[model samples]
Target chain A: MAERIALIDYGAGNLRSVHNALLAAGAGDVAVTDSADIVRAADRIVLPGVGAFGACMSGLSALPGMIAALDEAVCRKNRPFLGICVGMQLMVDSSEEHGSHKGLGWIDGTVRPLAPSDPQCKVPHMGWNDVIPRGAPPLLEQGEAYFLHGYAVESDDGADILATTDHGGPVAAAIGRETMIGVQFHPEKSQRYGLALLERFLKWRP
Target chain B: MTLRTRIIPCLDVRDGRVVKGINFVDLADAGDPVEQARVYDTAQADELCFLDITASHEGRETMIDIVERAAAVCFMPLTVGGGVGSPDDARKLLLAGADKVAVNSAAVARPELIRDMAQRFGSQCVVGSIDARAKNGGWEIFTHGGRRNTGIDAVAHAELLASLGAGELLVTSMDRDGTKDGYDLDLIRTIADRVTVPVVASGGVGSLDHLVAGVIEGHASAVLAASIFHFGTHSIAEARAKLAENGIPVRRN
Candidate 1:
């Protein structure tokens, strides 16, 4: 039987790129759709996002039945779900990018700007950086991934962090709970390691 | 984990085919944009640049087609430039799968365009491209594919672009472009020192040593080249190997 992968599209940015990347990562049954029924039916779910937190949250909530469908699929159904970049930020309790914007509250954290104590550290934190695994998550090896974001997840509990990266100081790179995982990097942009990670996500049973 | 230095391969496209020239003249066909982009991505190029040297209305449409096709197969970050007149133009390119849109002529004509792009797409997606030629005493910014000098001081304009919310700078030296001599380290160093954003050193890069100099001496966040990588004289793997040997950290392919 083929795996049905739902690449969620609630008009978030980088959807096309993520779709193309999912196909590249050997997902034979990848479908980019906005319908909750499609999302609820899929065996796996991938959410890709970019831009500011306020805008992204509005875009996601703009579709009437999206949040409920996603809640049922990810939280209730316990399906394997993955969030990228701003999508990962949505897993936090809130974001401070443009003000305090509420998030999905799936993880105990707030999305805050990467204000490295050192003045030399640049904003947006763009480019490829190493993702050091804090605890072993299936198929997620320690390697570099392309990261481009000004804000990151400030997890309330250290146990929620699956990985970390340094930009003047250590920042949350990936978070995990059961089969659900979120990464603050662009696997589509990170060549080999990214493809490998995606392949692992596809084959991940837990 | 450390942030790795990037190596970018730039492909100038005209009517959907890859073209090359020295200082933007006497163009020669290299290959298909899709082909070259796929090759570079598979080779693990940090990023690929697709510059539409011909900015005609029809050419813009063709560039979009090229981007869509290349993006379907290439997973790495792609930066598109060549006549982004407005935020809408940048938006179209970004929607078509470009990770970043570089503005040069339009940005030089109206500095507000840079701010507008940044405001719309966020500064992280806006790249300010400057082609500079050494003039009397210093370098002046050039536009229209490096055919015209704008008389604007390169460093001053770069600072303005940065202040206007440009996330990155792509500085090309006209004197050294296609010369196979080496990058203008002095020019790159000067502008890099003044800007807080990442600076990409473009033009000239004949040898591996030159790539090293771009990071070590010029202090560039990335090094972009055309002929060397296009002509197959040097590969991204080779450049990364050389950079690592020289004590610079680069992502392995």
Candidate 2:
């Protein structure tokens, strides 16, 4: 049977780009759905989002069955799980944007705004940034990828962090333990380098 | 670490195909926008800017269909401009998958338009585009594809635009346009110092060294050029390598 990948579509951001990116990266059995049954049966799962952290949490919270399915698939099955952009932050405990919105709490951390000390450093941290890989993961062996975000998850659980990118300070880029992986940058939009990273994720054996 | 100087490929679209020349002349017809966009997308360009050069004069709605089509094929964030005079226009383009909307003459004519668009959308979505020409030993702002002079100081105008809520400035030196000599570093430095937001230096980029100088000496956030890339003179990969060799941190392919 083909390895199935379930992309969670919570209607909070762009799903087509991520779906297309997976397809382009040679993912054969990619399915974008919010159905619990499909997610539970999938071989891997992807959570993608683009927006404020509070809005994303509300959207995912509204889908209780999907959330439960994702938790079971990731925690119980130990199937590979990847989160992009705000989806990565949702893996943390909470966020500072629009009040303290609770995250999925998969990883122990809190999301906060980018530092405001450097007047030269623009917010939203839009465009390409360098990534310093911490672990010897094939997914992040490649150097850097594009980044666009206003807030990031700062994890005290340093073991979960796979990479860091510097702005005013070093911020988490990829986080994971066992089958759970979260990338703060959009691999779907990082051009060839990003596609390479996604391909590594698809081929990752955990 | 030293920031990488971006090598941006600007596409000026009339109808749907890309066109070019000094002040939007010569009009060499390029391939379909989607196809061209895919080419650049594969080339690993630092960024892409698409200007709907004829949408306003032609009295047609913004070519949102084109934007959507291009976005579908290319994953890089696209900056769309031309005929974007109002917040609604910015919203429409953003909704159509454009990462940002660049306003030129419209923002100059009514500076408040910048703040309004930035407020409705976000500051990150607003880009202030200025076409500048040398006048009386100083640069003057030009409007309507550099056909009319605004008699405003380019440096002062950039400062005002940033203060008015422009997240970035796309400053093009019309006098050096299409000349392929080098970027006007003098103009770039003046505007870069004036704006708090990112400054994208445009016009008259000839060599890889020119791109490096624009960022290192001029302190530009990014550098945009045409003809050189469109005419197949230099590949994006080679340009990036050169910049990186010079200690500029480009995101390598």
- For every candidate, the chain B TM-score is 0.94, 0.92
| Model 2 misplacement above 4 A | A1-4, A34-42, A62-69, A116-124, B1-3, B21-29, B56-62, B85-97, B109-125, B133-141, B149-166
Interface RMSD, prediction 2: 2.7
> Which docking band does candidate 2 fall into?
acceptable
lDDT of each: 0.86, 0.80
Top-DockQ structure, candidate number: 1
- lDDT tens per residue, model 2, B179-253: 888888999988887666788889988877888888888888888887777777788887788878877778754
TM-score of each: 0.94, 0.84
What C-alpha lDDT, on a 0 to 100 scale, does residue A81 get in candidate 2? 90
* Candidate 1 DockQ vs. native: 0.65
lDDT of 1 by residue, A29-145 (tens): 988888888988989999888777888899889877888988999999999999999899898789988789999988889988788886546666878888988867655788888
Worst 10 residues of 1 chain A by lDDT: A117-126
The DockQ of each candidate is 0.65, 0.32
Question: In model 2 chain A, where is the ten-residue run with the lowest total lDDT?
Answer: A135-144
